[model samples]
Target: MSKPTPLSGFPEWLPAQRMIEQNVVERIRATFELYGYAPLETRAVEPLDQLLRKGETSKEVYVLRRLQEDPGARTDDSLGLHFDLTVPFARFVLENSGKLQFPFRRYQIQKVWRGERPQEGRYREFLQADIDVVDRDNLPFHYDTEMPLVIGDAFASLPIPKATILVNNRKVCEGFYRGLGLEDPDQVLRTVDKLDKIGPEKVAALLVETAGATDAQAAACLKLAAISTGDASFVDQVRALGVTNDLLDEGLEELVRVVDAGTEYAPGLIRAELKIARGLDYYTGTVYETQLQGYERFGSICSGGRYENLATSGNERFPGVGISIGVSRMLGLLFGHNALTISRSVPTGVVVALPAEELRPACDRIAQALRRRGISTEVAPAAAKFGKQIRFAERRGIPFVWFPGADGEPDTIKDIRSGDQVEADAATWAPPAEDLIPVVSKA
Candidate 1:
């Protein structure tokens, strides 16, 4: 037999690490439900054309093929693994429009695959927690604000650090570029989206060479991207830029509403950043990007935007706003830094010991009694010495070890951490609330 080599991009966690991941996911799921978002899941694969609808992401898509299929005999749409949840979700909405409720809100947590190079917080395969709200025709502007508030609540509920949602309006950037007499605003946006990747100077060069922007226009765009505020003051800052257009005015008003809502509800959680050009072409309105307070250099951990027509049937349009949290990316970062921990490596709260092979049934009954009371219990594997049995429990971080009664006397449970042993009845005894499940902590 040969030792197996590990794959670089695919991530797998140990038991304790996975415990933290599961806890984080459950917290996110509960938060999504709290906001009235129903759980939904889409198929793992979609038509290649459907997955490639968004041009920028097409190169990242992984095409699918069956190993045993006869290539020449097949005649069907080419299929590919979904890169993100949004595209399939849009297709789902359009297909089930008649059966679904209007203003549909759904939360999806699933694994997504991408063909990009993996880094510290990036993986070829990962999990995403997404929430989207779509309306039949025109989606309300309030949803743009609600999206961030929901994100704020979810992040606040987790053990992670405080997160800031950096928001921008596509209209703001388009109007500002128009005010500067730049003919192709989207090109400038695509270029500015690379500002963090390539330096500002390269982005400025790209704006001029590719987007046909004059030096003054490129400089103005750079300046606009530099303005970011925590509250409504960003409205005044954009006004100070002296770029006035009808679309710009509308965008500023909407942004003011979003900032105000954040201020009123989740203060200091939202930031108005003009330069955040969410690279997707479908985002026609508000766009969002989130960063952990101390990990801004790592880039956005969650991001999304409002699409005017994510799904359509003839003239009917399904407008939607959404945000997706990169669960795997976040956990990768946290786990790499040893920033998160679980109190136990296993779920068992108590390990019932057997004094002899004859006492096995007694231990089994006691284990059943504890389990009936909603406590996780496991029986010792063998009738080993008391010291060896305690070691087994200690090795797995099991807090309590139950020693059955001798000669039909009362049983005793030992708290390994404190070495406190006391008489207890299996039906009535229980571990403390905090010890009932693995506790997650942040370093």
Candidate 2:
């Protein structure tokens, strides 16, 4: 058979890179927990109908089936892998409303599948870190501003390149489309979402050709899409486009509040953008798209928006707002460009070399002592040349190499990176604090 084929965009990390991913996940969890958000996990698959409820045509869902045991078996749970966690979380909240408290705050980080064509930082499968607060009834407007700050803090805490979160409001987007006489606001949204894929010129063409917009109306929509500024005054520029509707006005006001609120707490965190029409149909209020500085070609590594009842049995309302970070996609860009890196390969704090066959037990005891002290330790595999042993530690980035001092003596700990040797008591030795905690890197 041919050699195993490596699928594109499904990048896998070695031990070092995996640790960086874990570090990122841990940091996100820590921040979320610090703010009193409880952790949650939702099933990976949902009925296809549930997945398709919002009419996301471009969302390439991975449908699943059980291996056939009988021909006549049927299932109503025709399932597909969820494209994102927000949708499933909405379903979870609605289904378990009685058990969960109101204004539920949750954090979920898990793998989601989407079958879109592989791009620089996008793939068929990836990890998403989402944090959201859903109220039993109408969601408080403060969350629109608070959620972005929470997400911005998560990004700011990382060592990756600085991120810019572009904020928008769907009511404003729809209002503009309606003012332009576009028959279908949702269709206009899908067209505008493609602005990055296709230029504004083509977006205009698609709206005119497919969505029934006249040339003048299409131009106005394109003009509205081009409106992006650094401050609330951007609203003045957007209104300059001559669109009028209270829904649009409300969206604009909400986004302005977000910018103002973000500036008060975390200055320069969120910026209002008229062009950022989140294509998702469910998003009713403020929407966010996070882009990495110097990696704009990589596209938005995080995105989400407000929704009106993620889980609706037709009557009950569960409005919520949230943002989700594409952890895997961000890591891909981070590692590819050396934006995030680790300093070591293995977690070995110290590796003791056997001076002779007779001295093996002493080395084992020392290593075990370190382990008991909550330090990482490894004993040399077998009796080998001292040079070879030092090479072993060096190869794995094991900083400390312990050698039998002299004729069955204590030992010495050598800093491999600095090449500094220090005589110490192997029984109760302590490495430098950072040395005890090994630095991680990208593969």
Candidate 3:
């Protein structure tokens, strides 16, 4: 048979790259659990109506259907692979609201699919790591501040480049546009969100054409978008724009709180960038967009926002704030650039040397002993010569090779890289802490 062609959107990493990705994900999970966020997993598909509730996302949803099934067999056509985690999470909360505690904090790491053209830092199927805080009735404003701090800490623990969390609030944008007499703030938002893709001139033109704004009003919106600061100074900057409304003031106060918390906790990690108008309509308050340093053109590698009414039950509202790290996008970009490195391709720290086929069980016992003490060990595949066994470990980046006791003599271990062999007992011996697992670092 001929060689199969490679698929464009689905990424499969090499063993070394996979090791780095797993290390990065474990670090993210550790940071999330440190903050008391419980782990969660949700179904990959959601009802079509639930997926379509968010504006402008229908084009990205991958519908699910069985092959050879009659189209008219079902009364309703209502299932699609979820494009993002937040929507399904909202449904999960509503479905199990009774069994959950208020202010549910969850961190979900899973694969999400999108039916869009794949490019650099974008894929049709990718892993997303998300953390969200949701509560019945009104969710506290502090969660908006906390979301970025958590993300900042998570990214900080990883070896990737620094990620600056750019923040904005729907209240601020909507109130400012309303003060300008523009009736459709959402249209203005969707247009301004294209500023990074399309230039400011085109965004302003689109605003006038699509949002029904005059050229001057469009210019004013650009001015607001241009206001970015590392501290609460953004509040005064927006005030200087001469837009005033109760909602604007409220948003300004909430944004200041978020930025100030960021300053006090993770300085220089979060910035108030007014241009980050997240296109989702559910974001009623704060919105966040994260740009990796030196990879800013790849777009936001992490993003999410505060939603006041995404989840609800009868006469009840579950407000929430969240942020998601594009795990696959991030690793893909890094791997493409050759920016990440791992200590080895596999996790085995020691390969028990096989002297003869008759001694396979003895080697297996040695491996088991090492494994019981939290060491990663494996037996040599063949009863090759001693030198061949050492070379086998070297090829896979395995640090040590263990030889079983000759007759009644104590067993010995060899660090192949160093050519140092020493008498050791499997029941008591251990590799150096750094050698126990693959270490991921920036190249």
RMSD of 1: 1.3
TM-scores, all candidates, are 0.98, 0.95, 0.97
- What is the lDDT of every predicted structure here? 0.91, 0.83, 0.91
- Model 1 C-alpha lDDT per residue in residues 359-423, reported as the tens digit of each score: 89988999999999999999999998999999999999999999999977899999999999999
Residue 23, candidate 2: how far off, in angstroms?
1.2
lDDT of 1 at 291: 95
- The local distance difference test score of model 1 is 0.91
lDDT of 2 by residue, 1-443 (tens): 98999998677888888878988998888888888889999999998888988757445898888787455666566789998898899899989998999899999999999888997778889999999899977888998888878888888778777788889888888887887777798888888889988898899899888899999988888888888776788788878887788878888888889888887877777777777877667888788999988988767889998898566776888999889999999998877777776666777878888868887787788888889888898889888898898899888878888876886655787887888887888668888888786564323
In model 1, the Cα lDDT at residue 257 comes to 87
- How much is 104 displaced in model 2, in angstroms? 0.4
Off by over 4 Å in 3: 75-77
Q: What does the lDDT read for residue 202 in candidate 3?
A: 99
